[model samples]
Target: MNTFKTEIVKTKEQSKTLAIIVVVLFIIANLYIFLIEKENQNVYLKSISFVIYFLGLFFLFGQSFIKPKPIGFFEIADTSINLRLDESQDTLLFIELDNIILKYTGYGSWWTHSIYGNKNYLLIACKNGENYNLEILLRNRSMKNDFKAFLNTEALQEKFQLKKTKNTTCEF
Candidate 1:
Protein backbone atom coordinates (compact mmCIF):
# COMPACT_ATOMS: atom_id res chain seq x y z
CA MET A 1 0.00 0.00 0.00
CA ASN A 2 1.16 3.53 -0.72
CA THR A 3 0.03 6.83 0.76
CA PHE A 4 -0.21 9.66 -1.75
CA LYS A 5 -0.55 13.35 -0.99
CA THR A 6 -1.26 16.37 -3.20
CA GLU A 7 -1.05 20.04 -2.42
CA ILE A 8 -2.05 23.21 -4.25
CA VAL A 9 0.98 25.19 -5.32
CA LYS A 10 0.94 28.79 -4.20
CA THR A 11 0.92 31.52 -6.83
CA LYS A 12 4.20 33.37 -7.20
CA GLU A 13 4.68 37.06 -6.40
CA GLN A 14 4.54 37.86 -10.11
CA SER A 15 1.21 36.10 -10.32
CA LYS A 16 -0.11 38.13 -7.44
CA THR A 17 1.09 41.31 -9.05
CA LEU A 18 -0.64 40.41 -12.26
CA ALA A 19 -3.83 39.61 -10.44
CA ILE A 20 -3.74 43.05 -8.85
CA ILE A 21 -3.33 44.68 -12.22
CA VAL A 22 -6.29 42.73 -13.55
CA VAL A 23 -8.43 43.82 -10.63
CA VAL A 24 -7.52 47.46 -11.28
CA LEU A 25 -8.43 47.11 -14.92
CA PHE A 26 -11.72 45.48 -14.03
CA ILE A 27 -12.54 48.35 -11.67
CA ILE A 28 -11.77 50.88 -14.34
CA ALA A 29 -13.92 49.08 -16.86
CA ASN A 30 -16.85 48.81 -14.53
CA LEU A 31 -16.64 52.48 -13.61
CA TYR A 32 -16.59 53.43 -17.25
CA ILE A 33 -19.51 51.20 -18.14
CA PHE A 34 -21.72 52.08 -15.20
CA LEU A 35 -20.93 55.64 -14.09
CA ILE A 36 -19.35 57.36 -17.02
CA GLU A 37 -21.31 55.90 -19.91
CA LYS A 38 -24.60 56.18 -18.04
CA GLU A 39 -25.64 53.15 -20.07
CA ASN A 40 -29.01 51.70 -19.15
CA GLN A 41 -27.63 49.02 -16.85
CA ASN A 42 -30.23 46.73 -15.35
CA VAL A 43 -30.32 45.05 -11.96
CA TYR A 44 -28.75 41.86 -13.27
CA LEU A 45 -25.83 43.73 -14.71
CA LYS A 46 -25.45 45.71 -11.51
CA SER A 47 -25.35 42.54 -9.46
CA ILE A 48 -22.74 41.00 -11.71
CA SER A 49 -20.70 44.20 -11.63
CA PHE A 50 -20.76 44.22 -7.86
CA VAL A 51 -19.74 40.58 -7.70
CA ILE A 52 -16.76 41.16 -9.96
CA TYR A 53 -15.75 44.22 -7.97
CA PHE A 54 -15.95 42.28 -4.73
CA LEU A 55 -13.88 39.45 -6.10
CA GLY A 56 -11.20 41.84 -7.33
CA LEU A 57 -11.03 43.59 -3.99
CA PHE A 58 -10.93 40.28 -2.13
CA PHE A 59 -8.05 39.00 -4.21
CA LEU A 60 -6.18 42.23 -3.91
CA PHE A 61 -6.43 42.37 -0.13
CA GLY A 62 -6.29 38.67 0.60
CA GLN A 63 -3.44 37.67 -1.69
CA SER A 64 -0.76 38.38 0.89
CA PHE A 65 -2.41 36.15 3.48
CA ILE A 66 -4.22 33.49 1.52
CA LYS A 67 -2.36 30.22 1.11
CA PRO A 68 -3.09 27.31 -1.22
CA LYS A 69 -4.77 24.24 0.24
CA PRO A 70 -3.93 20.55 0.05
CA ILE A 71 -6.78 19.26 -2.05
CA GLY A 72 -6.21 15.54 -2.52
CA PHE A 73 -4.64 12.32 -1.28
CA PHE A 74 -4.84 8.72 -2.34
CA GLU A 75 -4.34 5.47 -0.46
CA ILE A 76 -4.03 2.22 -2.34
CA ALA A 77 -4.58 -1.19 -0.89
CA ASP A 78 -4.50 -4.34 -2.98
CA THR A 79 -7.85 -3.97 -4.76
CA SER A 80 -9.26 -0.56 -3.98
CA ILE A 81 -8.23 3.08 -3.93
CA ASN A 82 -9.14 5.59 -1.24
CA LEU A 83 -9.23 9.22 -2.29
CA ARG A 84 -9.24 11.66 0.59
CA LEU A 85 -9.68 15.43 0.69
CA ASP A 86 -7.90 17.63 3.14
CA GLU A 87 -9.83 20.08 5.31
CA SER A 88 -8.60 22.90 3.17
CA GLN A 89 -9.60 21.32 -0.10
CA ASP A 90 -11.91 23.23 -2.37
CA THR A 91 -14.84 21.40 -3.92
CA LEU A 92 -13.74 19.98 -7.27
CA LEU A 93 -16.10 18.19 -9.62
CA PHE A 94 -13.99 15.03 -9.91
CA ILE A 95 -10.45 13.66 -9.76
CA GLU A 96 -9.32 11.01 -12.18
CA LEU A 97 -6.46 10.54 -14.62
CA ASP A 98 -8.24 9.92 -17.90
CA ASN A 99 -10.56 12.94 -17.87
CA ILE A 100 -8.29 15.17 -19.90
CA ILE A 101 -9.75 15.92 -23.33
CA LEU A 102 -7.46 18.61 -24.78
CA LYS A 103 -4.03 20.21 -24.56
CA TYR A 104 -2.30 23.48 -25.45
CA THR A 105 0.55 25.77 -24.40
CA GLY A 106 0.78 29.42 -23.29
CA TYR A 107 1.72 31.50 -20.30
CA GLY A 108 -1.22 32.07 -17.92
CA SER A 109 -3.57 30.25 -20.22
CA TRP A 110 -6.99 28.89 -19.27
CA TRP A 111 -7.14 25.90 -16.90
CA THR A 112 -8.11 23.81 -19.92
CA HIS A 113 -4.76 24.60 -21.52
CA SER A 114 -1.51 23.25 -20.13
CA ILE A 115 1.05 25.99 -19.46
CA TYR A 116 3.93 23.81 -20.54
CA GLY A 117 3.66 22.78 -24.18
CA ASN A 118 3.47 19.03 -23.61
CA LYS A 119 1.79 19.00 -20.19
CA ASN A 120 -1.79 17.77 -19.73
CA TYR A 121 -4.68 17.74 -17.24
CA LEU A 122 -7.83 15.88 -16.20
CA LEU A 123 -11.20 17.45 -16.95
CA ILE A 124 -13.24 16.78 -13.87
CA ALA A 125 -16.98 17.24 -13.99
CA CYS A 126 -18.10 20.42 -12.31
CA LYS A 127 -20.60 20.58 -9.46
CA ASN A 128 -23.15 21.66 -12.05
CA GLY A 129 -22.55 18.30 -13.71
CA GLU A 130 -20.72 20.01 -16.56
CA ASN A 131 -17.11 19.16 -17.37
CA TYR A 132 -14.82 21.41 -15.35
CA ASN A 133 -11.18 21.04 -16.31
CA LEU A 134 -8.32 21.20 -13.84
CA GLU A 135 -4.65 21.31 -14.70
CA ILE A 136 -2.59 18.39 -13.37
CA LEU A 137 -0.05 20.94 -12.06
CA LEU A 138 1.82 18.34 -10.09
CA ARG A 139 5.08 19.56 -8.61
CA ASN A 140 6.53 16.07 -8.78
CA ARG A 141 5.33 13.98 -11.68
CA SER A 142 7.36 10.87 -10.68
CA MET A 143 5.74 10.80 -7.25
CA LYS A 144 2.30 11.10 -8.86
CA ASN A 145 3.06 8.16 -11.15
CA ASP A 146 4.09 6.00 -8.22
CA PHE A 147 0.89 6.90 -6.41
CA LYS A 148 -1.19 6.04 -9.46
CA ALA A 149 0.43 2.63 -9.70
CA PHE A 150 -0.35 1.98 -6.06
CA LEU A 151 -3.96 2.93 -6.62
CA ASN A 152 -4.21 0.45 -9.48
CA THR A 153 -2.86 -2.44 -7.46
CA GLU A 154 -5.17 -5.42 -7.10
CA ALA A 155 -4.81 -5.87 -3.36
CA LEU A 156 -6.03 -2.35 -2.71
CA GLN A 157 -9.17 -2.92 -4.79
CA GLU A 158 -10.25 -5.91 -2.71
CA LYS A 159 -9.52 -4.18 0.57
CA PHE A 160 -11.46 -1.00 -0.23
CA GLN A 161 -14.14 -2.44 -2.51
CA LEU A 162 -13.43 0.34 -4.90
CA LYS A 163 -15.85 1.24 -7.61
CA LYS A 164 -14.59 2.18 -11.06
CA THR A 165 -16.25 4.78 -13.20
CA LYS A 166 -15.70 4.79 -16.95
CA ASN A 167 -16.05 8.56 -17.44
CA THR A 168 -12.79 9.68 -15.82
CA THR A 169 -9.40 10.11 -17.50
CA CYS A 170 -5.88 11.19 -16.51
CA GLU A 171 -3.26 12.77 -18.75
CA PHE A 172 0.31 13.74 -18.10
Candidate 2:
Protein backbone atom coordinates (compact mmCIF):
# COMPACT_ATOMS: atom_id res chain seq x y z
CA MET A 1 0.00 0.00 0.00
CA ASN A 2 1.19 3.49 -0.82
CA THR A 3 0.85 6.18 1.85
CA PHE A 4 0.83 9.92 1.13
CA LYS A 5 0.62 12.66 3.72
CA THR A 6 -1.46 15.81 3.28
CA GLU A 7 0.25 19.13 2.59
CA ILE A 8 -1.33 22.58 3.11
CA VAL A 9 -0.15 25.42 0.93
CA LYS A 10 -0.08 29.11 1.84
CA THR A 11 -3.73 30.09 1.67
CA LYS A 12 -3.62 33.53 3.25
CA GLU A 13 -2.31 35.07 0.05
CA GLN A 14 -4.76 33.17 -2.10
CA SER A 15 -7.67 33.98 0.15
CA LYS A 16 -6.76 37.64 0.23
CA THR A 17 -6.52 37.81 -3.52
CA LEU A 18 -9.75 35.91 -4.00
CA ALA A 19 -11.58 38.12 -1.56
CA ILE A 20 -10.41 41.22 -3.37
CA ILE A 21 -11.48 39.87 -6.72
CA VAL A 22 -14.89 38.80 -5.46
CA VAL A 23 -15.58 42.18 -3.87
CA VAL A 24 -14.58 43.99 -7.03
CA LEU A 25 -16.76 41.76 -9.16
CA PHE A 26 -19.68 42.14 -6.80
CA ILE A 27 -19.46 45.93 -6.99
CA ILE A 28 -19.13 45.88 -10.76
CA ALA A 29 -22.07 43.49 -11.17
CA ASN A 30 -24.37 45.59 -8.99
CA LEU A 31 -23.36 48.78 -10.78
CA TYR A 32 -24.00 47.22 -14.17
CA ILE A 33 -27.39 45.86 -13.13
CA PHE A 34 -28.68 49.08 -11.62
CA LEU A 35 -27.18 51.51 -14.08
CA ILE A 36 -27.69 49.78 -17.43
CA GLU A 37 -30.57 47.35 -16.81
CA LYS A 38 -32.75 49.86 -14.99
CA GLU A 39 -35.71 49.50 -17.40
CA ASN A 40 -35.91 45.76 -16.85
CA GLN A 41 -34.78 45.73 -13.21
CA ASN A 42 -36.16 42.81 -11.27
CA VAL A 43 -36.20 42.93 -7.48
CA TYR A 44 -35.90 39.16 -7.12
CA LEU A 45 -32.66 38.95 -9.07
CA LYS A 46 -31.17 41.82 -7.13
CA SER A 47 -32.18 40.23 -3.83
CA ILE A 48 -30.72 36.91 -4.92
CA SER A 49 -27.49 38.57 -5.91
CA PHE A 50 -27.22 40.21 -2.50
CA VAL A 51 -27.94 36.93 -0.79
CA ILE A 52 -25.38 35.06 -2.88
CA TYR A 53 -22.72 37.66 -2.17
CA PHE A 54 -23.45 37.61 1.54
CA LEU A 55 -23.35 33.81 1.62
CA GLY A 56 -20.21 33.75 -0.44
CA LEU A 57 -18.56 36.15 1.98
CA PHE A 58 -19.66 34.04 4.91
CA PHE A 59 -18.16 30.89 3.40
CA LEU A 60 -15.02 32.70 2.36
CA PHE A 61 -14.38 33.78 5.92
CA GLY A 62 -15.41 30.34 7.18
CA GLN A 63 -12.55 28.82 5.20
CA SER A 64 -10.08 30.16 7.76
CA PHE A 65 -11.50 27.86 10.42
CA ILE A 66 -12.45 24.69 8.58
CA LYS A 67 -9.27 23.02 7.37
CA PRO A 68 -9.45 19.54 5.88
CA LYS A 69 -7.19 16.99 7.51
CA PRO A 70 -5.95 13.84 5.82
CA ILE A 71 -6.64 10.95 8.14
CA GLY A 72 -4.82 7.91 6.65
CA PHE A 73 -3.50 6.15 3.60
CA PHE A 74 -5.42 5.15 0.47
CA GLU A 75 -4.54 1.46 0.34
CA ILE A 76 -4.82 0.48 -3.32
CA ALA A 77 -4.65 -3.09 -4.58
CA ASP A 78 -6.00 -5.25 -7.42
CA THR A 79 -9.59 -5.82 -6.30
CA SER A 80 -10.45 -2.60 -4.48
CA ILE A 81 -9.30 0.74 -3.07
CA ASN A 82 -9.34 0.60 0.70
CA LEU A 83 -9.69 3.94 2.43
CA ARG A 84 -8.30 3.74 5.93
CA LEU A 85 -8.95 6.74 8.08
CA ASP A 86 -6.67 7.05 11.12
CA GLU A 87 -4.49 4.34 12.73
CA SER A 88 -7.15 1.62 13.00
CA GLN A 89 -6.54 0.70 9.31
CA ASP A 90 -9.97 -0.97 9.31
CA THR A 91 -10.72 0.48 5.88
CA LEU A 92 -13.36 3.19 5.57
CA LEU A 93 -14.60 2.10 2.16
CA PHE A 94 -13.69 -0.68 -0.24
CA ILE A 95 -14.07 1.31 -3.46
CA GLU A 96 -15.32 -0.80 -6.34
CA LEU A 97 -14.97 2.24 -8.50
CA ASP A 98 -16.90 2.20 -11.80
CA ASN A 99 -16.84 5.78 -13.01
CA ILE A 100 -14.46 8.65 -12.28
CA ILE A 101 -15.16 12.24 -13.24
CA LEU A 102 -11.68 13.26 -14.30
CA LYS A 103 -12.44 16.93 -13.74
CA TYR A 104 -9.06 18.60 -13.70
CA THR A 105 -11.06 21.75 -14.38
CA GLY A 106 -14.07 23.36 -12.70
CA TYR A 107 -15.29 25.20 -9.66
CA GLY A 108 -17.95 23.64 -7.37
CA SER A 109 -17.22 20.42 -9.26
CA TRP A 110 -13.58 19.27 -8.95
CA TRP A 111 -10.00 20.46 -8.52
CA THR A 112 -10.27 23.13 -5.84
CA HIS A 113 -6.85 24.75 -6.00
CA SER A 114 -7.73 28.37 -5.38
CA ILE A 115 -8.92 28.41 -1.76
CA TYR A 116 -7.20 25.31 -0.49
CA GLY A 117 -3.62 25.02 -1.64
CA ASN A 118 -1.71 21.73 -1.69
CA LYS A 119 -5.05 19.99 -1.33
CA ASN A 120 -5.59 17.23 -3.86
CA TYR A 121 -8.87 15.41 -4.25
CA LEU A 122 -10.64 12.56 -6.03
CA LEU A 123 -14.37 12.11 -6.45
CA ILE A 124 -15.27 8.50 -7.12
CA ALA A 125 -18.60 7.02 -8.04
CA CYS A 126 -18.66 3.30 -7.49
CA LYS A 127 -20.55 0.50 -9.25
CA ASN A 128 -22.93 0.23 -6.30
CA GLY A 129 -24.11 3.84 -6.65
CA GLU A 130 -22.07 5.25 -3.81
CA ASN A 131 -20.17 8.51 -4.26
CA TYR A 132 -16.87 9.00 -2.45
CA ASN A 133 -14.60 11.99 -2.15
CA LEU A 134 -10.99 11.95 -0.97
CA GLU A 135 -9.33 15.27 -0.16
CA ILE A 136 -5.69 15.07 0.79
CA LEU A 137 -3.40 17.98 1.43
CA LEU A 138 -0.08 17.22 -0.23
CA ARG A 139 2.95 19.41 -0.97
CA ASN A 140 3.45 18.29 -4.55
CA ARG A 141 1.79 16.59 -7.52
CA SER A 142 3.20 13.15 -6.75
CA MET A 143 0.01 12.03 -5.02
CA LYS A 144 -2.16 13.09 -7.97
CA ASN A 145 0.14 11.25 -10.43
CA ASP A 146 0.26 8.15 -8.24
CA PHE A 147 -3.53 8.08 -7.91
CA LYS A 148 -4.04 8.34 -11.69
CA ALA A 149 -1.50 5.57 -12.21
CA PHE A 150 -3.36 3.38 -9.75
CA LEU A 151 -6.63 3.97 -11.55
CA ASN A 152 -5.00 3.04 -14.86
CA THR A 153 -3.83 -0.36 -13.64
CA GLU A 154 -5.08 -3.58 -15.29
CA ALA A 155 -6.97 -4.75 -12.20
CA LEU A 156 -9.42 -1.89 -12.50
CA GLN A 157 -9.22 -1.85 -16.31
CA GLU A 158 -12.53 -2.27 -18.07
CA LYS A 159 -14.72 -1.16 -15.18
CA PHE A 160 -13.24 2.30 -14.88
CA GLN A 161 -14.09 5.32 -17.02
CA LEU A 162 -13.26 9.06 -17.03
CA LYS A 163 -15.77 11.89 -17.14
CA LYS A 164 -15.39 15.47 -18.28
CA THR A 165 -17.37 18.62 -17.50
CA LYS A 166 -17.50 22.25 -18.61
CA ASN A 167 -16.08 24.21 -15.73
CA THR A 168 -13.01 26.14 -14.63
CA THR A 169 -9.72 24.60 -13.53
CA CYS A 170 -10.60 24.70 -9.85
CA GLU A 171 -13.71 25.20 -7.80
CA PHE A 172 -13.93 26.46 -4.24
Candidate 3:
Protein backbone atom coordinates (compact mmCIF):
# COMPACT_ATOMS: atom_id res chain seq x y z
CA MET A 1 0.00 0.00 0.00
CA ASN A 2 1.15 3.53 -0.77
CA THR A 3 0.42 6.48 1.44
CA PHE A 4 0.91 10.05 0.31
CA LYS A 5 0.27 13.45 1.82
CA THR A 6 -0.31 16.51 -0.32
CA GLU A 7 0.95 19.87 0.89
CA ILE A 8 -0.06 23.36 -0.16
CA VAL A 9 3.02 25.04 -1.55
CA LYS A 10 1.87 28.58 -0.72
CA THR A 11 0.16 29.73 2.46
CA LYS A 12 -2.69 32.28 2.81
CA GLU A 13 -0.28 35.00 3.82
CA GLN A 14 1.95 34.26 0.84
CA SER A 15 -1.01 34.39 -1.52
CA LYS A 16 -2.16 37.71 -0.07
CA THR A 17 1.30 39.19 -0.43
CA LEU A 18 1.51 38.01 -4.04
CA ALA A 19 -1.89 39.54 -4.88
CA ILE A 20 -0.94 42.85 -3.22
CA ILE A 21 2.36 43.01 -5.07
CA VAL A 22 0.68 42.38 -8.40
CA VAL A 23 -1.95 45.05 -7.73
CA VAL A 24 0.67 47.54 -6.61
CA LEU A 25 2.72 46.94 -9.75
CA PHE A 26 -0.29 47.42 -11.99
CA ILE A 27 -1.24 50.64 -10.18
CA ILE A 28 2.32 51.94 -10.33
CA ALA A 29 2.58 51.29 -14.09
CA ASN A 30 -0.76 52.93 -14.82
CA LEU A 31 0.16 55.91 -12.65
CA TYR A 32 3.46 56.28 -14.49
CA ILE A 33 1.66 56.34 -17.82
CA PHE A 34 -1.00 58.76 -16.61
CA LEU A 35 1.34 61.19 -14.86
CA ILE A 36 4.70 61.01 -16.64
CA GLU A 37 3.73 60.22 -20.23
CA LYS A 38 0.44 62.15 -20.09
CA GLU A 39 -0.63 60.00 -23.05
CA ASN A 40 -4.39 60.02 -23.38
CA GLN A 41 -5.08 56.38 -24.15
CA ASN A 42 -8.41 54.96 -25.29
CA VAL A 43 -11.00 54.02 -22.70
CA TYR A 44 -11.22 50.50 -24.19
CA LEU A 45 -7.51 49.90 -23.63
CA LYS A 46 -7.71 51.12 -20.06
CA SER A 47 -10.76 49.00 -19.34
CA ILE A 48 -9.21 45.89 -20.90
CA SER A 49 -6.00 46.32 -18.91
CA PHE A 50 -7.93 46.84 -15.69
CA VAL A 51 -10.07 43.79 -16.34
CA ILE A 52 -7.08 41.56 -17.03
CA TYR A 53 -5.18 42.89 -14.04
CA PHE A 54 -8.08 42.40 -11.62
CA LEU A 55 -8.90 38.99 -13.03
CA GLY A 56 -5.35 37.79 -12.31
CA LEU A 57 -5.42 39.46 -8.92
CA PHE A 58 -8.69 37.73 -8.03
CA PHE A 59 -7.28 34.35 -9.05
CA LEU A 60 -4.27 34.83 -6.79
CA PHE A 61 -6.34 35.98 -3.83
CA GLY A 62 -8.95 33.25 -4.30
CA GLN A 63 -6.26 30.60 -3.90
CA SER A 64 -5.99 31.42 -0.21
CA PHE A 65 -9.63 30.60 0.48
CA ILE A 66 -9.56 27.21 -1.21
CA LYS A 67 -8.06 24.09 0.39
CA PRO A 68 -4.89 22.87 -1.24
CA LYS A 69 -5.18 19.61 -3.16
CA PRO A 70 -2.60 17.42 -4.79
CA ILE A 71 -2.49 17.95 -8.50
CA GLY A 72 -1.22 14.37 -8.87
CA PHE A 73 0.35 11.63 -6.79
CA PHE A 74 2.67 8.76 -7.68
CA GLU A 75 3.08 5.68 -5.56
CA ILE A 76 5.63 2.86 -5.64
CA ALA A 77 4.82 0.11 -3.16
CA ASP A 78 4.58 1.89 0.23
CA THR A 79 6.28 5.13 -0.84
CA SER A 80 4.40 8.04 -2.38
CA ILE A 81 5.61 10.91 -4.50
CA ASN A 82 2.97 13.56 -4.26
CA LEU A 83 3.27 15.93 -7.18
CA ARG A 84 2.22 19.44 -6.30
CA LEU A 85 1.52 20.25 -9.96
CA ASP A 86 -0.65 18.44 -12.47
CA GLU A 87 2.07 18.14 -15.06
CA SER A 88 4.13 15.99 -12.66
CA GLN A 89 1.64 13.16 -12.98
CA ASP A 90 2.62 10.14 -15.06
CA THR A 91 -0.73 10.19 -16.88
CA LEU A 92 -0.07 13.63 -18.33
CA LEU A 93 3.29 12.78 -19.87
CA PHE A 94 5.55 9.75 -19.57
CA ILE A 95 8.85 11.51 -18.89
CA GLU A 96 12.17 9.71 -19.37
CA LEU A 97 15.30 10.79 -17.58
CA ASP A 98 17.34 9.96 -20.68
CA ASN A 99 15.17 12.39 -22.60
CA ILE A 100 15.79 15.12 -20.03
CA ILE A 101 18.75 17.45 -20.55
CA LEU A 102 20.42 19.16 -17.61
CA LYS A 103 22.08 22.54 -17.89
CA TYR A 104 24.21 24.43 -15.37
CA THR A 105 25.32 28.01 -15.91
CA GLY A 106 25.78 31.30 -14.13
CA TYR A 107 22.70 33.41 -13.46
CA GLY A 108 22.03 35.91 -16.23
CA SER A 109 20.95 39.56 -15.88
CA TRP A 110 17.26 38.60 -16.15
CA TRP A 111 17.70 36.07 -13.32
CA THR A 112 18.56 38.87 -10.89
CA HIS A 113 14.89 39.90 -10.93
CA SER A 114 13.90 36.44 -9.68
CA ILE A 115 13.30 35.72 -5.96
CA TYR A 116 16.27 33.35 -5.83
CA GLY A 117 19.30 35.54 -6.36
CA ASN A 118 22.13 33.83 -8.29
CA LYS A 119 20.67 30.40 -7.48
CA ASN A 120 20.79 27.21 -9.55
CA TYR A 121 17.79 25.48 -11.06
CA LEU A 122 17.66 21.84 -12.06
CA LEU A 123 16.21 22.25 -15.53
CA ILE A 124 14.38 19.10 -16.66
CA ALA A 125 13.60 19.23 -20.36
CA CYS A 126 11.31 16.79 -22.15
CA LYS A 127 11.91 15.15 -25.52
CA ASN A 128 8.31 14.95 -26.73
CA GLY A 129 6.18 17.60 -28.43
CA GLU A 130 5.53 19.10 -25.02
CA ASN A 131 8.49 21.33 -24.21
CA TYR A 132 7.93 21.32 -20.47
CA ASN A 133 10.71 22.51 -18.20
CA LEU A 134 10.89 21.88 -14.44
CA GLU A 135 13.03 24.49 -12.69
CA ILE A 136 13.84 23.38 -9.12
CA LEU A 137 15.60 26.19 -7.28
CA LEU A 138 18.57 24.79 -5.42
CA ARG A 139 18.63 25.88 -1.76
CA ASN A 140 21.52 23.84 -0.42
CA ARG A 141 24.05 21.18 -1.44
CA SER A 142 22.18 18.45 0.51
CA MET A 143 18.93 19.28 -1.23
CA LYS A 144 20.64 19.23 -4.59
CA ASN A 145 22.12 15.82 -3.85
CA ASP A 146 18.73 14.49 -2.72
CA PHE A 147 17.08 15.81 -5.87
CA LYS A 148 19.70 14.15 -8.04
CA ALA A 149 19.34 10.91 -6.15
CA PHE A 150 15.57 11.00 -6.55
CA LEU A 151 15.92 11.59 -10.26
CA ASN A 152 18.32 8.67 -10.59
CA THR A 153 16.26 6.29 -8.47
CA GLU A 154 14.61 3.20 -9.92
CA ALA A 155 11.36 4.01 -8.18
CA LEU A 156 11.17 7.33 -9.97
CA GLN A 157 12.08 5.61 -13.23
CA GLU A 158 9.26 3.08 -12.75
CA LYS A 159 6.85 5.75 -11.64
CA PHE A 160 7.63 8.07 -14.56
CA GLN A 161 8.42 5.19 -16.96
CA LEU A 162 11.70 6.74 -17.96
CA LYS A 163 13.06 5.30 -21.19
CA LYS A 164 16.19 5.65 -23.26
CA THR A 165 15.78 7.43 -26.56
CA LYS A 166 18.30 8.11 -29.28
CA ASN A 167 16.59 11.23 -30.57
CA THR A 168 16.96 14.26 -28.35
CA THR A 169 15.03 16.59 -30.69
CA CYS A 170 11.63 17.86 -29.56
CA GLU A 171 9.10 19.19 -32.03
CA PHE A 172 6.87 22.08 -31.07
> Candidate 3: minimum summed lDDT over ten consecutive residues — where?
163-172
Candidate 3: lDDT of 26? 71
lDDT string for model 2 (30-57, tens) is 6655675766767877776676567566
Ordered from best to worst TM-score, the candidate numbers read: 2, 3, 1
Please provide TM-scores, in order, for all candidate models, with all chains considered together: 0.28, 0.42, 0.29
Please write out the lDDT profile of model 1 over residues 47-69, one tens digit for every residue. Answer: 76777777777665544344333
Regions more than 4 Å wrong, model 3: 1-98, 105-118, 122-128, 154-172
- Model 1 segments beyond 4 Å from truth? 7-67, 86-137, 148-171
Instruction: Point out the higher-scoring one by TM-score: 1 or 3.
Output: 3
Error of 1 at 54 (Å): 22
Per-residue CA lDDT of model 3 for 77-171, tens digit only, reads: 22333334555454223343234443332221332322221222223334554443433333233433444555555545543323223331211
User: Each candidate's lDDT (Cα)?
Assistant: 0.43, 0.52, 0.40
Question: For candidate 1, what is the TM-score?
Answer: 0.28
lDDT of 2 at 100: 50
